[model samples]
Target: MPSPTLTRVRQAYARIEAVDRPEVWIGLRPQAEAEQEARAIDARVAAGEHLPLAGKLFAAKGNIDVAGLPTTAACPAYAYTPWEDAPVVARLRTAGALALGTTNLDQFATGLVGTRSPHGAVRNALDPTRISGGSSSGSAVAVALGIVDFALGTDTAGSGRVPAAFNGIVGLKPTRGLVPTTGVVPACASLDCVTVFARTLPEAEQALAFMASPSGRELPALPQRAPGPWRIAVPPRAQLGELDEGWAEAYEAAVERLAAAGAEIRHLDLTPFTDAAAMLYEGAFVAERYTAVGSFIDKLIAEGDTGLDPTVAGIITRARDIPAHQLYADQDRLAALRTRALTQLGDADALLLPTAPGHPTLAEVAADPLGANARLGRFTNSTNLFDLAAVAVPAGLTPAGLPFGVMLIGPAFTDERLARLARLLQPRLRLAVVGAHLSGQPLNPQLLSLGAEWERTTATAPVYRLHALSTAPPKPGLVHVGEGGAAVETEVWRLSAEGLGQLLAALPRPMVLGQVELADGTHAPGFLCEPDALPGTTDITAYGGWRAYLNH
Candidate 1:
C-alpha cells in the first residue's frame, strides 16, 4: 500500500500537470520516477530509519544537475546530461527528498528578470501578468504554487533571493562555499552560492543544513544569536532609492512592526554596501561571468547559432574588452569596501532591508529589460559580494495585492542566526514549554484549545534553572540564571497573537510567560517564574525537566 506521503507527492505532481504555466519547468522528472523515489522513502520510514526530509518533494534550477535531467542553465544549446546529481542535490536525495524536475531560469543565469529565457518567461505563481523575479524564477514559482516542498536555486547576484521575494516565499542564501558547488553550472564561479526556497524559515534552514558542506573549508559552523533585543541596521531614508508606492509603504510598515517586536532599528549610511553592489555588474565582476562560459559562447557564435539571448551574449562579449588591470583594480577596491561594510555592521545582529525596490509588471521589464532588472538588485546584489548570508521573507502584500518582502542579512556563517531572527517577523510566535503544557501532559489541552501546534522537542540552554513551583497543579518555572544551570527538556509550540493572549490571560501567579533561553542561545516565550518565587520552590534543575521530576 502507498504511504500518505507518497499519496501527497502524487497529488502534487498532478497539480503541476494541471497548472497552465508550462514555462515554470524546463524538464520534469517522469511521474513514475518521482513515485518510485517517494515509495522508497516510505519504505525507509517503515523500517524505522529517520530522514530529515523524508518524502519531501523538491525542484532544482536547471543550472544544477539531477542525474537524468539535462543541465540547461536555461539555454538549450548549453544543455548536457549528467551521470550524477550535483553534490547538493545528492545530499537532499540522501536525506529522502524526492526530485520533481529541473525548473527554468534566465539564460546562462544572466538576467535578474525571468523573461530572458528562450523557453518562455516564467509567470508569477499568484498573478500571471507580473514577472517572476529571476534567474531562479521557476524554482521559486514551483515552491510558491505548492508543487514542491522546497527548491534549490543559485545566487551570485541575488538570483535566489529576488525570486523568493517576488513569489512570497522564504529564500535562504547561505554563506558562499557553505554548500558545495560541484556539479552545478556556474555564472560566476568564485562568487556563486547555492540557495534554498521554501514556505517557512525553519524549512529552508533544514534544507540548507542537510546540503551544507561538511569539509569546513569555507563552511564554518552555522552561527546562533541569543533572542532578546536584536540590533537591526536599516539604510538611511535618502539611500532607500526609488520604490513603488506600495513597496515604500510596506517597507516603512515592516520597520515599524520590527520595532514593535523589540528590535532596535538603527539607520545608517549604506554607501559601502551599495558601492560593492555596483562592482558586481558595473565593475570587474562581470568578467567572472565571461570567464566561466566565454569560450563556449564564442564557439556558439562562430557556428552561427544566434539562439542565445542578445542581452546575455552582449554582456559576455563586453567582458573581452575590459583590461586585465581593471579587474585587479576592482578587486583591490572591493577588498577595502568589504572592510568598511563590516565596520558599518558592528554591533548590529543583522541588516534589514527591502528585498527589492519594487514589483514590476511583465510589460515594464519588456520595455527596458536591463534597467528594470538592475533596479531589482538594488538591495540584493551587495550580499554575495560581501560574503554575507541572507534570508528573504514575505512581509505582506502591496496595495495592488502583489507580494512585498524584506531580507535579513548577516556576516558569513550566520545563516541559521538570520533564520532565527526571521521567525520572529512571522505572524506566529514560537513558545518553549518545559512543564505541564508539554505534549501528553495535562496542560497540553490549553495549547490545543488556542489552535497551537506542537513544533519540536528540544532542550533549554544550560544557563536555565528549572524549579517546581508550589501550586495545586505543580507547574515548572524556568529561570535564566546566566551560569551554573542545567539543560532541561522542552517542547516548542507555535500559536497566533490571539492564542498567546488567551494563554497569558489564563496564567496563574508566579508562573508567567517570559523569554527563556534555548540550548542554542535562541530565545522564545516560555514559562519563567518571578525571582522572588524561585527561592521557595524546590530546585528540580537536577531532574532535567518537569516530566523527569514528576516520574521521580
Candidate 2:
C-alpha cells in the first residue's frame, strides 16, 4: 500500500473503532480487504492515472448492494448476499472510493426515525442522546463522525435529508433517476432517489458526479458571471408550523445571511407543496411502499419471522390494501399539485426551508415514532414529490446546542444552482483580486495553477482604496479605508483550502491576504499591502482599478 493511503485507511478504521458505535454499520469490510483495495489504488496512482476520489473511503447504506457484504436492509430475515455491487456503489468504487462497509438503516428503508432498525438506533454523531434521523440514519452519522470521506444513502421521503440535519452535514439528494438504482433494494422505487452525505457541499457534489450515470440528464451549467442576486422563495412564518425553541430564530438568521449575500428572498404560499407532502404517506402514494417490499415482508411474516420493525411492517402491511382506485385518484391530485407548486416556485432559483422541524431526542422518537418522523419530513417529503433537487447544508446551532439546517429546493436538473446557493449559505474561502491577479492579467496564472475558479466580478464595499504598489509585475494593494473610500473594482475567485495554503506560502512580503468586505455584504481573503510598502506607492483610487489605471 502507498504509505499515505494505507495510513489514511488505518486512521479511518481507528476512528471507527474509537467511536465504538456498532449500530453505525451493519457490516464492515475486513481491515485486510480494505488495505488491499487501498494498495491497488496506490498502484494506479503511482502509474500516473488521475482518480477523482482517490483514496477516499465511503460507506453504502445497507439497502444498496456492496459486493462481499450481504444486502441486509436492516432486516436479517430479508437479507441476501449480492454477488455484484449496486450500480451506484460500482460507479463510486470505479472512481477510487473504497467501500469501508454497509451501514445500518431503518428496516427496508421505512422510517424517518433511525430507531426502526433491528441492528439498533443510529446515534447522532453530535449527541448520542438525540435521534440520528433515518432510514439513511447510519449513512449520515458515518459522514458526520468523519469515519469516512462520504456515504451513499437512499431518499424516498426525507430519509436522506433529515439525517443530515440531525448530524450537521451536507446531504445532496440528486434529481430523480440521475443516479442509477440497479441492484439496490427498493423503498418507494419510483420516488426512491440516491443521496450522498459529506462534510461539505463540494465533496458531496464531487461524489455525486462520480456516481451519476453518463446517460442521465446533465445538470444545467452555471453562468460564467452571476446575472444578479438569486431569487430564493421562503414560506411564511405562520406556514412554517411550530418550530422548536431557537429554531425559528436560527432559520431566520440563515435567511438573513443569504439575503446579505445578495439573494432576493420572496415570500411564497406553500399550500401546494405542503399538501403534496401530506400525500406521500397520508394519501394513496403509501401503496408504492407496499409495492416495493410487501411481498418479501409478507412471506417473512407468513413464515413466522419477526425481524422487521413492527412499525415498518405495519406500514407496508396497511399500504398493500390501498385500493388501486385511490392510487389513481391521488396520482391525479398530485399531478395538479405539482403543477401549482411549480407555478408558485416559478422564476425563483430555489425554495429555502428548514431541513426538519427540530432535532428530536431518542425518547421523543420512541414515544411517538410516527408523529416525530412525520414532523421531521414536513419540508423534505415534498422534494421528490415535485421532482425537484435539493442540497441540505448546516445553518447553525440552535441556542439549545443542537445543530440546525436548511435546504435549497430547486427544479429538476437545477442541481448546480441549488449547490451554489447552498455554498453561499455556508462559509467559503473566496479571494478578491484587484490587479495583476484579475482574469487574463499577468499574475492570474498563479491562481489558475492553484485550481481556483472565478466566482464573479464585483467591487469592494465603498470602504476601500486601490493603490499601485511598487512591485514587479505591478500588483495593486486594496487598502481598507473607512472614510472617503471608493468602491474599488475586483473579481472574486473560489479555491480549495489547500490552494489557499499554497498561496500564503508564496505571497510576497508587501502583499498580504486579508479580509475584504464586498459590495454584496460578504467578506473574502483579498490582496492588501503592508503600511511600510505604501510610502512610495502611487495613489490610483481615481482610476477605479489596476487595468483602468494601466489603460489610461
Candidate 3:
C-alpha cells in the first residue's frame, strides 16, 4: 500500500490538475519530490515520531522564497531562483507541511485588486466573474478551494485579508515582525507581514505558531483565551458609506452576530483609521514601495521591457518624485494617527470591521483599476501602519449570493486574543433587549460588564405593546398582547448562562426575563414587564423603540 502521506500528496497533485487554473500558481513542486518528502514523513511517523502537519500541503506567494522556485513577485524580468526557503516557509516545512509551489501575486506586491500581474488574474473560488482580492490573491483562492491546507502571502496593504474575504477563507495577518521576512521580497519592508491563509481560524492559528520567530522579537505571550465579555469596537454607520448595496447589510448582520456572541459593542470614530489607510498610497509609504523594486523596474524600463504591469509601474514611478522631507513629514503624520486611533480604541478588547468595503467584479476593476482597488483596501490598509494584528473570517453570503467577511483586529501582539474572540463569532444562544440594555443607552454598560454581546437590532413580533415606566433614568416595559399590538424594535445579544443569571438577579421590580417573540418568528429571553404595572405606565408603542420615545 502507498504511504498515507504519499497518498495525500498524490491526491493534492490530482486536485491541482482538476482545478485547471494556471493563473493561480506561478510554479509547482515536482510531484516525485513531494512524494519523496511524504515518504520521509511517513517513516518518521512509523518510528513513533509525531509531526503535527504531517500530510499538509501549502503554497507560498511568489514574493516569498521557496527553495528551487523563482521569487518573481509576478514580474518575470525580476524573477530569480532562491537557494533557500524564507524562514517562515522553512519552519512550516520543518513542521512537516509540504510546499507545493509559489502562487501568483500582484506584481511587486503593489495592488490590492490581484490583476496587476503578467500571469492572468487569479479568479475567485466561488464566483469566477469577480476578482479574487489580491496581491495575495492566489494564496487565498488556493486555500478556499481546498487545493492546499494553508498558504503564505505577504500583507503590506490589504493584500492578505482582501483576498481571503473575496475568496471565502481565513486570513491571519500576524503582528508585523512576528514572522521573519529575511528571504521575502520587500513591498514596504517596514510594514510588510507574512500572512497566512487557511480554511479555518484554528488551522491558521496553528500555522502561525509554526511560522512565528521564537526569539528575534521579545513579544508579549499570546493569551490562551480572551476573558469573556470582550469589548469589540465598530465604526459608526456613516463610516461605511463605501460599502456595496448588500455589503452594509451584511456587515450589520455580522455585527449582530458578534453581539449575540456576548461582545460589548463600542462605537468608535474611524477617521483616524481611514486616514491612516489613505496614507499608505497617498503619503510617503508609496516611496517605500519604490525603494523595494523601483530601481530594478527602472532598469527594465531603460532596457525597453514593457512586461511590468502598467498600473504598478506608474505607481512606483510617481514615488520617484517624492522628496526625503515629505517622507519624514508623512511619517510624523502617521505617528499622530496611530496614537489617536489606538487612543480611540481604549479599553476595547478588539476592533471588528468588514474585511473589505465590498467585493468587486473583474469588469468593475477593469473599468477603474486604481479607484476600485483603492476602495478594496479602505478597511484593510491601516492595519500595519497602526501596528495591529488582524484576522479575517468568512461571515456569510450576501443577498446577492456573494461571500462576505469580517475582521477582528487587535494591538500588535494580541494575535491570540483576537483568535479567541473570533471563535465567539459562531452561532450561540441569543437574548433580546428592548430598552435599557440597548447599545449607547444608560444601562447598556451593565450588560457589557456582565459580558453580554449585542447581536443585531430587530423588532418584536408585532404582538407586543411598549410602555414608559415611572423610574429613574426611565425604562421601557414590553407587554405581549394577543391582539391589537405593534412591533417594538429591540436589540439581540448573547450572554453566558452565568452572565444571564447575574443579570436576572439584579432586575428591578416589574421587569422580568422571559421568552419574547421576534418579528422574524424567533423567540429569545428578553426584557418584559408584569401586566399589573400597566395601571401606572404610559403607552408609548407608537414611537417603535426606546430611543425613538426618548427623542420624541
Considering TM-score, which of the candidate structures 1 and 3 is the better prediction for this target?
1
Q: What would the per-residue lDDT of candidate 3 be over residues 147-176, giving only the tens digit for each residue?
A: 888999999998989998888778899888
Minimum summed lDDT over a 10-residue window in model 1 is located at 216-225
Please write out the lDDT profile of model 2 over residues 304-351, one tens digit for every residue: 897878999998999988888998999899999999998898788999
Clashing pairs in 3: 256-455, 259-453, 259-454, 260-455, 262-453, 263-453
Error of 3 at 499 (Å): 26
For model 2 the TM-score comes to 0.78
Q: Report the Cα lDDT for residue 132, model 1.
A: 96
TM-score of each: 0.78, 0.78, 0.77
Flag regions of model 3 displaced more than 4 Å. 220-228, 427-552
Among all windows of 10 consecutive residues in model 2, the one with the lowest summed lDDT is 217-226
The 0-to-1 C-alpha lDDT of every candidate, in the order given, reads 0.86, 0.87, 0.87
lDDT (Cα, 0-100) at 255 in candidate 2 = 94
Instruction: Judge candidate 3 at residue 49 and give its lDDT.
Output: 88
